[model samples]
Target chain A: MPKAPRAVVLLGAQRFDPTLVEAVKDLGIKGRIAAITAGWQEREEEDDDLEEHLATLSVTTENLRLHARAEEVFRADPEFHKAHRERQALLRHRQDFYRIRLEHALDAAQVIRQRQAPEAILEDEAHASIQAIRDLDHMHLSRCAIDRGEFEDRYRPLKRPALAKHRSEIAEIIAGSEGVAIAGGHVASLLNRLDLFGIAPMLGGKAIFAWCAGAMAISERVVLFHDSPPQGVGAAEVLDAGLGLAPGVVVLPQPEFRLRLDDKERVQLMARRFAPAVCLAMPERSRARWKSGRVESQQGGVFELREDGTHALSVARHSVPPMKGHVAS
Target chain B: MTGLTPLAITTLMMPGTDARKVDEFLAGKQFPLTEGPNVTFVWRGDAEGVNLRHWIYGLETATALSRLPHTDLWFLTLDIPEGSRIEYKFEVLRNGKGEWIEDPRNPNRARDPFGANSVLQAVGYEAPDWSTKDDLARPGTIDQLVFDSPSLEGRRNVQMYLPARFRRSRQYPLVVVHDGKDYLNYASMKEVLDNLIHRLEIPDVIVAFTDSPDRLREYANDEAHARFLTEELVPDLAARFPLYDRPQARCLMGASFGAVASFSTACRYPGFWGRLLLQSGSFAFTDIGKRNRRGPLFDRVVEFMNRYRNEPVAVSERIFVSCGVYESLIYENRSMVPLLDATGMQVRFVEARDGHNWENWRDRLREGLSWVFPGPLMFVYE
Candidate 1:
């Protein structure tokens, strides 16, 4: 039997989109894949447990990776390392100062606890914890070496090696596979960096699959909704860039049943706000597949957002014909 | 202040007797009753076979008072606004005349902030449900269990609520809610979970409601509270139940002070929680003293966001944030939601119609839960 294709899932701040599983299954792949979480600072024990869970889920463990970008090495260089070390030392010192301040706070808390009862103590503990972390984060950032403008520029180069390594490993896993599925929202960021570093030509002849943030990142432009000054990452920064691998803008997965009626309205508004961008809104557990730019409903129905801002939904039927291709100019 | 005089009077009514009943009886006797700071009555009563004019004022709040006759009236003049409703009870003298009574004008009553009992009325707002009965009595499947500060036993209350399809044997994702009383019961959180679970909107998950009574003092101080959770609570919960035994299966949630706790805890510990639900969090409280005195907590929250802006966060840990348009803290919550998202956390922002009350918090629970547990619905039939 042929070795199954391997995939990488870049989780968003929310839960994983279930449609990725279906997309993978449809691609005739049956192998364990790695789920890489890239955003937050994690506790060691928790990180270990998460790795164990993903491994249990059959994702390849040997190659499981984190975003240990080469920037750390650059920052650690002797010339730059001094500034970094000094900043780190300052952060550590400030943290210690705050910890002492907390002793006074704890003492006050004890008095309140004595008067109020056990519950008061619990509330006090939670308050103290939140304060300490907030203080620590503030202390660390005030001492960071890079400014926002310089940081963004420098950050681009730093991402290249990480993406190259990820791609090479993925290439090895899916050596002879006809198609590969890249599940996750952050995958687009990796794809974009790959194109920037001129690594896209290296993985020729392989079909690409993307969903949620993964799909959004691979499109002509990845829309950053969560960003205040909405950012758009282009094909160079977005790895899949229609990958010529598929067509049409992938509507990332969202929630199906919104708690508030306004939530649906907000999502629709987002789609409208990005008009002519071929906005695709995939609800949780649902998916949309694009072949050669023409979108088709798969598992989940496809909703076409017209230029007039009106949306049309076509339900999924067993006898539906496969969608044709249309190039995004 | 001309009429202000220190007066002392003690009245008693029979136990278990409604004070209002006596007031009604006195009303029929053609006595003049005036209620201000207390209930005062001037009535003609026969004393030793001679008719005498008597005055009575109820200074204490009582449902029942000891019965007495020939009461001596010690009247104190007090300046009170007209139409003001006060609560008081009358005291009887040695002469068997006056008895304790309730204020007729103000039937509603409330507890005074001070230790001494006084007369007042209920503010007409609905009181929180303090009844400790668990309507859903069966032990719920443990999705995630966290125990913080084991050495401080009995000081904490471990609260657990199972999703609609909860079962004893099945392991589920655990979302731990800080300020458990406010989130689970006071906010009608269980109902939100039930609706989401039943609709297949969100995946089946276990919710551990951790009590945080001293929230203001502890949550934002030293992460000692988070340590209690990560070190103590997680271990204790894991051992006792079949919860999702991994960090990816764990989540943390809170609002206001609780919100700061949830965000700070997750950021500090990172992979410990896969999801975070924060509503009207005070993210901007930068200076603790200033925040405690006059500044809103949002100042500190902004400091937290700026610091962690580029830190590698649990990119996989999803976050849901909501705030009422009328709530003063909405701006902070809104700004933090995107900040967390920019740092690579999955974040959903929501705006509601209400304020920072249980009603709005209750509504956000279902939406927030669904965001964290989006997957195929699994129903556990009892």
Candidate 2:
């Protein structure tokens, strides 16, 4: 495996209007940039607009086509494909069971937060409630790890000729590229392709730029969150362990559209529940760069959620470092 | 006075008030003046007789608005329930011939295919912000799917809503909407779907928007129409697009007669369509006598509803039924909810203050779609 990446830059959703060119310029990345739009699945080849946009900066992009390669591997080895399918089903089942507990724990936390009581007692109970949610998240992630570990142990996917051939090609692309740009789409599909090809090992010692689902996939943990869904009370749950490229951060993409930030209780609850790891809310035009296991630089009104409320990154910069001390729950 | 509710208009109704005071009261004040549950409607100009014509069931259809003693202002105040949204027009009598016109003072209007009506939102009612197009939300594209259906013995054109960033490898849930054109034109279906999906309120799914050539006959729970949707359209769509084959991912939705078509279609192929969203269904059923008072159009609708009520089988896994309290079909929709729930299926029922119109159906789309096919908000992390 190569050395750790020089830096990892995460951004908001880039579908409607992308600020990727601005981010790329800020990083001073020139020459060929390896692009992974595997999350786009069958439409992975349809990156004309993205390619044109990058061409303006005089930066050529090479799509890794991890999704297509994964498909090829599956076709070549039906046994590995069946095992992958079974693993996905197991993960889904785990998530379904996890949600039931997560919801109840969140509900209990909310109730305690709202209860009319003395401030000191309320603070204690609120912390306890948040801990319960954290415990549930930890438990869920651990179980997901077990499922993934079992699959990897049984199949030993990297040893297989089908996946090994593609991995070597992808490694060659990364070796020749200045930086890697991962675009967002279906997060699960994106993570699945990333995991199957084992691209994390090759991502070291290069500048990495990812946005939306891409940002979440590279983080320490993949957290699915929405404060106000149409039906039922939405509780953010741990999907699985991420690529761990950008450690000590839980990246929430498009928070301006997903989260009810004005609600202090919900904000505080989310921040405290995911304590140690910085919960970053990346809205449109937002950018955050991680280097040396800390937030090196950030732009836009990117928010760092706290126990009181969400503070802009300018005022909350100090909180991101302690996040590195405790990377996992 | 600019923000005064209709209940406060009594001060202007005093006998001593002159035209100057009335003009001052009218200047810049939004109408119909809504204060709590009381809404005061004001109409300006001369007429032989003026009446407030509204489409609210169980209430007087036309209530005369008395003209102030010395002013041209005609005012009528009524106690409208909080959270109720109603559409009304002023019936101005000119030379013994009545002409119905939208409110001159009320700027809020709801447009339908026929025309537009003045909108009155009571105290707690607010139009959903998500229904409007947002520049930030990525818009979904609509494509036409033309096919020949042997079941209907004709060619059918369906407009498909492929969500932004749609992928062929990902299998999406399917929502087949009846009366598709009306939903697109009046309900703002595309905008709502785009916003809802962008906001993670509902999953990014493929929508098959279908319209009938002969809506009255075909949407009356006709057997051929059911076959056309289940046997023909669905198979073609599945073959063309990457859609989930499971019943849980399939849904059938419509409003009024179109709603009847969705319900009957799901019933015919039980467990095939797992979700049903029926809005203001024209379920005119007779508990005792077989008399149908809703005219010839409702003859077949009443027959299907009556038979379904008697059997009350579990057709779908989940059913979301909504109706306007002001609509004549409210009683039927309300009664059908309990019967549907009794079938051991998940049932959700919602009621609004508005009448049977496209906007009312449009307002319920978010809740219906989200509840049926909840998005990544609840489950998927990436």
Candidate 3:
């Protein structure tokens, strides 16, 4: 059999969503697939357990470490130190606030618990009342992060060793794989760095697959929607060129939950402004296969564009059902 | 010890009202209160009569009033447009005090960072140029024509966009889009193509927007709509335009259910369409609850794939796929991406931060068209 394509899996910033890994395996073109967990500096014992689980799939898991020299540079940077201090302060404040809130909430729950009397005529109702209080307390504690404005900064920074290891492992994976699949937050940044280091070129002869952030990183440009005054990353903004694995603009995938017209228009405007070599929008589960220049869809999906100043939709046969009710006559 | 204080009085007046007397009284005076609309008279709290302290007035009350009193008030009566609802506010000295306050007369107010308060009239939008329907007529090249699909009679309308460079002189690629009206009219697709072609982004191409006929049934069934595009519409468009006779030059694109049609048609007739652009396609056969009640659409898709897995693509074609970052169907799209890539076909997958919509689709059009036809004549803005 054709050597199963060697595969490299990158996981660092975001926790791996199990469903994403299963999807990769389902593709069936596999050799050795490895997961490099290099985003976090200090790995807890629980992380080792997760690594073990990943190993069961014939995928090796390793933690990449940064060199001492890089660590020295990071420590010497005043701005980095300042930012780190601010983050620490913010974290402490949040922790204190949450602790107080949790205490208060638990106290309220205890009060409700004490009100439940065994002799009460409505025993089930009284138990439900106590449960409801506990649920409310839990919700309050969960929402404490929002109140403290530290939700975004909650993720602790990874140590230098971990960061360097991740970069090296990703490079190694790309070099060995017949194909590579990457999924996670920070995938775009990682891809850009890899491209800069010429790691992406190693996979030039192989097929590459990226989902969500991973997909965005491989494109010519990655548009970040998380920032205010929306900004474009990768080649367009000169932040860093993407892996250049795919030519064109990378659209940050938009969900289909809010059925608003203006929201759709905003997305279109962003795409036009960025004007990547290609723009991709995944409103649903759609796949397009490219072969020798011919791109074909294997599922139900739609692609729209302006032609001669008019818009057109290319519909795949199997995916046209949900849209049956909305087309104009 | 001797203490002395002078009492000053000031009066307020509305715009277009006589306020010359009040202005003269407050000239060079300390603690002076300026005259404004909506205030009839004022009293001074200051001991010095030389210093006008406050002014109040019910300057004017008229339904046809042009301007109200407040900071930044400019009133020049002219023939304003009819049926216009103007917003304005009046500022007046409160109870003989120097404090000028906003009008209590106006009912409309706007919320802002400062606080909720009245605002000036908003400029109305000029009417769009709806004067001519010249676009209704078919161009000379495509011979602007309309088709009533017997398969979708009265159920759908299909619009064709022939490149401005379209000539009876040569054959051109044909691309079929599912949401005809959205592509042709709503998205200004014709203009996009014109610009793209002018910029030489893609080669000369003909676009036939075959609207979904009862989008629910046609897109869901896939068979009906696919048949309509391949069997009925393709022949019709070819007869009308100088379309390339071979399927190698043919392409399909759409989003959601429209995406389904694009892939299904290509799979069914692998030789017919050489290019495809799938944006946020609904490829998860299990999730489409009601539509797949009879049977799973995935079976058909898999069957098509199995049948055509080894078939040599007539002409090297390209496929572009993309989805939103937060879209629930992202996993499904990811799953499908590898499947398509495994077919030994060129696949470009894209992910954006938005859900399924025309905006992203319009952008995808720009990129996908360029990929499908990487030559001069594809749509691009100047």
Candidate 4:
């Protein structure tokens, strides 16, 4: 079996304001870094901004073009493409059913918590409410896993010739590179491409840097969340089981824009519902590192949300570990 | 003096004030003074009677201002609602003659086809920060496409907004806008598109802005106009540009009469444009008779609206309607929402404290555009 990654660095939105350079410099990595921007879909090869940013620190960048590869695979194997579409439809149906249950459960929890009662009773009810949500989340996640597991069992897509060839090519690229950087895009697309290529195992022992959907794709479970959507009620839902590379953490990217942190009830509910796994809010320019199966370091408004609803993220810069390699010329 | 606004101090309490005090008060201050929901419009010239001339429906069009006893300052304080944007002009009566002019003291003005009016943004009313030009946002290029349309039997000019990072290899959602030049000039549309696209609030899109020489005649549910858009313009643009060949990737947007053009076009070609962003649409309809209060200009519009009301269909999948409460068309717009929603299409109607002008349409662009064609930001980012 492949060993665990050296460090799983999760950053915030890296489109307009990127902190990949700082993350790279801190890691003392000055060599070739493989990039997976499959989430960008048709615009997969548009990594000029990212390349330029990393180039400032003399870090050579290589876009793996997994999205393009997936397209090629689909074109080459129409049967695989049809199966993938069918699987996607199955997952979507499961999600719709799960949403119906999750919404009612979440509403019941909120109602119970807000009811007029004694302090002790209210506290107990709040706990129960959180537990109910957590239970539903676990149930939903398990059902999704079964759906995905069944599909994987039936298809055995990794054994397919096209995917296998690309996986080998990708593994070889990662082997040559020092680290892998994954940029943000549509989360579901990113997760799908990553799973299709089976690039998780190949990331072993390499410094893995990801942000936005990229960060979410690496976690044990991917949660789709937005506090205020334009049309519908914003509910956090379990998308699917992620790569499981970074465990015991629910990453919320662009929290400042996506979440209403001022609403204490909402903050408390979100934090408590995802207990055991720390609910980390990664705003722009924020960074959090997962090492040894836990968050070892964080900085730049990287917040650990608690049930109290306080939003005082420590702005003080943390000390960086000593450099192990010389600066690139 | 401790807790009152500057205008309140000068207008209410001061019994023995001079021109120096009034000049001092007016200096270095932005007008009109907006404190909470109350807006005080101040005029600093000598006149027999100064009236606030506005077009806000349901309110007295011409409201007289009270002059200070010792100074030439005339002021009128009206309790405006939060998030309401009103526009008005000052009708100064000098030497027994009334001369209408834009607010000399206020720099914020909104221009329209008719003329210009001074803008008053109450508390909680702010033009989206993205409406302004940002140096960081890479600007898009606009290319003109002049073509002869057999449907309309005339030559038409359309300007295209290609996003800063537009690539021919990638397919883009297209939004065809009516009264294109007016939006570009008055609404700062290019700046808005640049900023929204740069910030990822909306995807990189190909916007086709179209104009008509005779909008009143052409845009009022004209079948030829509809044909020109659905047949002539859209197909031509699709062939020229890399556009997604699906209804969900297409949109038609306009304001007022322009909105009538978009609505009628979509009705003509149902399921062709998946989204419709209609702002203050001139959807004039009567419950009984064919005549409308908006007069002869809205005859064709009212005729079409009446017919659609009788037999409404789900022309598009989603629609975004925004109308200013201050405009005369608010009632028509408000009534149309339920009818549109009942057609089984997803409908969103937004009402602003504004009037029927370009700026009112401009202010609601973020909400209307983002909902219709959301970018990567609106997607699930975990």
Candidate 5:
């Protein structure tokens, strides 16, 4: 039987959006697929949606739960637990400082947006404002990585027997399955489980489909951003360093909700701040596929932010070539 | 506000009843229910000498009914708005207690997160059968478009609701709603429109479910958002669809900040979008730029609202404002009513007892749509 090429497929939100199912079916695999849904917290077994989708294609599924089994890790390794707590505390402190700087920079940007400053002055102010935010993010993200790495190096939590049991179980599951489906939720929770179990190595280059926090977890860095929330304005924070799987892009899921994409200054600042890492806007139905370490298709209405505070669709739509223009300050 | 008189009287043919004849009345005809433009809602065996009002239209929306002529049939023959789907319950003063009870006879009901309420589709109003998916009916098509906005310098996916009877050749009234997905999914607007258009309650219109990439920043009376709607989107829509060009045929709508977006668009582009359907709008404003003390999220929103208040410009020709009585922003919406009414624009204000939610906005859709786009067939009895 002809099979789809083994690859990593990054998708948008899948709770309501069934793009993941479509991607999984397109893989053309009849074998059982392992699933990671620790990100969903306690309600991990509620895999009815994924199950329903797979049932249509007649694919057997194995929903691997790291969340339900995290108690073992905590129970066995007291040192790892302490280290993890310290690391979380440090991360929180780092976030507080980052937030202060972010707030200040955002205030400056708001002032700049409202100001009728000269073009040169406006550009300078905007440039500095964006730089400040970028510096803050970079510093925070770096600090988080160092802190987590130090904890891991000191504790060697992955080597703990409690987690070792889960690792063997996950490895066995992945060995049988031709692919893996990772659903999104709490990104930290998802990453913690994935790292604890160390299932990435067991994948053996099998095809993986992930979306939302799942996609964010596999990225180089997981950024949490929301422009306006119910309580107040929200600043985008680099949550933590992700598993270096979906390389080189800030996966901003629900861009429709979080990003003020319409605002030139905000969008432009975001583009420049996250320079090099293509800040990919993944709303529902957005898709980006990586085959053999190469991004093959970013065609499912995927958009990439540019340096000049403008975004263009990664794929063409309705034969209308991508609109290209730098935003006027 | 203009007062309306009942066009016709509708009498129940069943036997007259008091508390003694309750069983007989029950066996004969369903009490507390009537049909017509002027239909009396009867509540059997009510104890008088207490504050009581018939909860009509929506939750907490009530009217006092006079005891019907010569019987215990407590009835009020109200000439309801020509085309309206009203929800009502009885507040009976019985056993020294006043409690609300749904019209047991009326089978039509609508439920939200709160609870259920009995619905009344008036003579001219037809309850959308498509509100519930019917296999027999041909469903309307919803074409999703990822529009690259030139004005705002971004891309947003808009869900366009084209009626089953849609044709490119015919110019249709255009209704642009904010929070496209919420209305379509949460509010079940596609179903409502499908049924409405199917039954000819509303005209076959082109609905552009325009979503906000960032709702708070854009919809808080933001200039960029206004430009995006009027400048970027409108022209794009005109080129694509057979849209009615006149302002009268164009409706800009939304709820919460979405309402602010529609209103701000109307203020910015006065002659462009004339029909406004604002549901539970966050018309946040402060005098002399004194911020709302809540947070800075609404600071700019207040600034814009104040600007509109200071310079009260005639935004639209006809406007329908719906809000929930239990909402925190009730004052804001209520304040906007008089402000809008004073602007020489036809303004209709409606409210329900429920809190601010998608369902509250959803229930107001039929009333708002029918009034805004009554088409040529619906006679305007002024």
Candidate 6:
């Protein structure tokens, strides 16, 4: 089997500043890293953030318009557009019910927090509650997989004549670049485009650096979360199956905003919910390194969610290594 | 203190009352002296500055709290009704910009998108005896679950309060509460439910606290939020819980945008929620006469309120609206009452002597919830 990508996740905000610059130097890369800002959506072409960050370095940045290219594919094929829209709407419809059930589980966990139950019983309740949410996530993911599987079984998007030119172009660009940098934006939009042009296969056995939604999109699963939003209520949700470049780690970008750090119950629940995977909070100036498909180091206040309801940047990265593939629930 | 009846002067105690909601402000404060209909509110606070104003919502403007001599404290005694509960904050003007703050001593509070407010419960506003913890009273079980949403591209929590007396053979009413966490920590809803059910004040209900992933964007008259409630939440809840089958048995509730969530859901999915318990709803509208005119912050709220006004539809069988006299949304809520009446729905509109906060909603529960899901003993007491 191909070795998992040697990926390093830096915080989304101020990701490329001195931190990313230092990371680039640490990796000792001399060639260009084909940077993918597909996550930026409409501003996919804008690399000012990347350009400015690496202005002094010999390492070059190449912008890949995966988002634009995906849009072109949709525009080129009417049948594919109809299928994609229908797929999205169906997932949304199904996801509503999934969310309802998920809320029920979270409420149960919240209730468990209030009771003066024994530690053992509390653990049991917490474990069961977390498992329940995980199970719901699994089911929703399965349905999504099926939906996409059905679509791909017929369309065979990569092999289609309409997508041949774009597919070959991306393959050649990624092959030429020594590394790839993915930026953040609308995660769903980014993931869809990356999936359409088949970046994951091309990214195999490559050096990858991602931040924010970019970091989240590279992992085995994409979990969207927020604690206090300007307009909406806060809930940590599993958005979709990711590219699986960084395995066994749920990268939580901007944990300061997304996490209810003071709320012990929520902290404990989130940690236990995405257990074994190490719900790593990628705050600003933080980094998590994966070498040969395993976590090698953590720095700059990078922390992992623990079962005991504590967050820490465990000194020993070898203690919880990243597996090559998905850690089955 | 002024122009009050003998009963209104009966100095109700200010300590030991439940905070009801703690996330908003300090709790366990409020002394009320009441006659038959009106009551006097006495609140104590410590001030660090001269311009100590009570930035109470629902009312027209802030009122200055008379500072006591030789003390860091200030007192405000205002007369209101027998069952009015309001939310208020102390605005200390320090270095120009007003600092809105919570009552240091008062335990009861309510929270909105803006911030926290101390709650004031008037006399005769009994928050059901069962709402209080009694070792003898059998409590319900609340469980948390995750709900995935593709439309909003999110997954949120759903808090379900199943009564201690749940049985597969038995059916119960469902009350969907928006702003789930606020209702839980702030409103003390779970305790309220246990107490209400134990007392049989309301029918045994399976309440689902439907949390908002985005309250401002999702809850403020947004159809997707409504769909999440009706299409996703309720249906999924009905499938699992042995809930009362009729739409009339279900209730949707919230305070502020949460109230807007309930109102908009009821409007969008008519009959989904049999009742709406709106407390100081931010129902901004300019078309409900000149008094309803509002600002740009209220533009989206105005659009929604106008849509419902132009097409007055039967959202719920009965609606209970409670807005504090000292709340920011009083005019808008006042405009809503007449419009609700015009919709041919049985409406009970209450003007709380307090402000826009959760205590106002918590105190009104006895009236609103009991009316919506009146138990068998409702007539016996009457």
Shift in Å, residue B290, candidate 2 = 8.9
- Tell me each candidate's TM-score: 0.37, 0.75, 0.33, 0.80, 0.46, 0.53
**Model 5 chain A — which ten-residue stretch has the worst lDDT?**
A320-329
DockQ of structure 5: 0.01
Model 4: per-residue Cα lDDT over B1-382, one tens digit each: 2246454544544676888888777788778887677788999888999999998998999999998787888998888889988889999999999999999889888887777889988889887788999999999999999989999898999999999989886679999999999999888899989998887778899999999999999999899999899888989998999997778789999999999999999999999999999999999999999999889988999999999999999999879999999999999999999999999887889998899888988888888888788665655452
Return whichever of 1 and 6 wins on DockQ. 1
Error of 4 at B370 (Å): 0.5
List the pairs of residues colliding in candidate 4.
none
Q: Kindly state the fnat score of candidate 2.
A: 0.40
Q: Give Cα distance to truth, residue B242, candidate 4, Å.
A: 1.5
Q: Write one digit per residue (lDDT tens) for candidate 6, span B118-201.
A: 655666565546445767668999999777866556887888888887887556888888887777776677787777666656
What's the residue-level lDDT of B373 in candidate 2?
Answer: 83
In candidate 1, stretches whose alpha carbon ends up further than 4 angstroms from where it belongs are: A1-329, B1-148, B151-155, B286-316, B375-382
DockQ for every prediction shown:
0.02, 0.25, 0.01, 0.28, 0.01, 0.01
Judged by TM-score relative to the true structure, which candidate is superior, 1 or 6? 6
Cα lDDT of model 5 by residue, A1-329, tens digit:
12223788888777675876678777787889898888876667888888888878888899987887775566677776667656655665686568656777788778876889799998888778777777787777777667756767777766778777777787888888989988887677687778767666666558888888888877777777666532134566676667656666777887776678777766776777776667888888888887644577775688977777788887522111111110000
Off by over 4 Å in 6: A1-3, A6-12, A15-18, A116-122, A230-233, A316-329, B1-382
Taking chain B only, the TM-score of every model is 0.56, 0.96, 0.55, 0.94, 0.66, 0.75
The global C-alpha lDDT for each of the candidates, from Candidate 1 onward, is 0.46, 0.85, 0.45, 0.84, 0.72, 0.70
Which window of 10 residues has the lowest lDDT sum in candidate 6 chain A?
A: A320-329
The TM-score leader among the candidates is 4
| lDDT tens readout by residue for model 4, A98-173 | 8667877887886786689999998888788778778888877777767767878888888999888988899899
Give the C-alpha lDDT of model 2.
Answer: 0.85
Alpha-carbon error at B98 in model 3, in Å?
A: 43
- Residues A1-329, model 1: lDDT tens digits: 22211322221212432344445555554454433322211211134433344344343422222333323333444544344334434433453354345434444544554564588676666456445433433343333222322433654433445445655664564444444434342342343333333333433444455455545544544433321110111101111133332333434344243112134433343343333344444555555554433444454544444444355553432222212211122
Segments in model 3 whose C-alpha atoms lie over 4 Å from true places: A1-329, B1-144, B148-156, B286-316, B377-382
DockQ of 6: 0.01
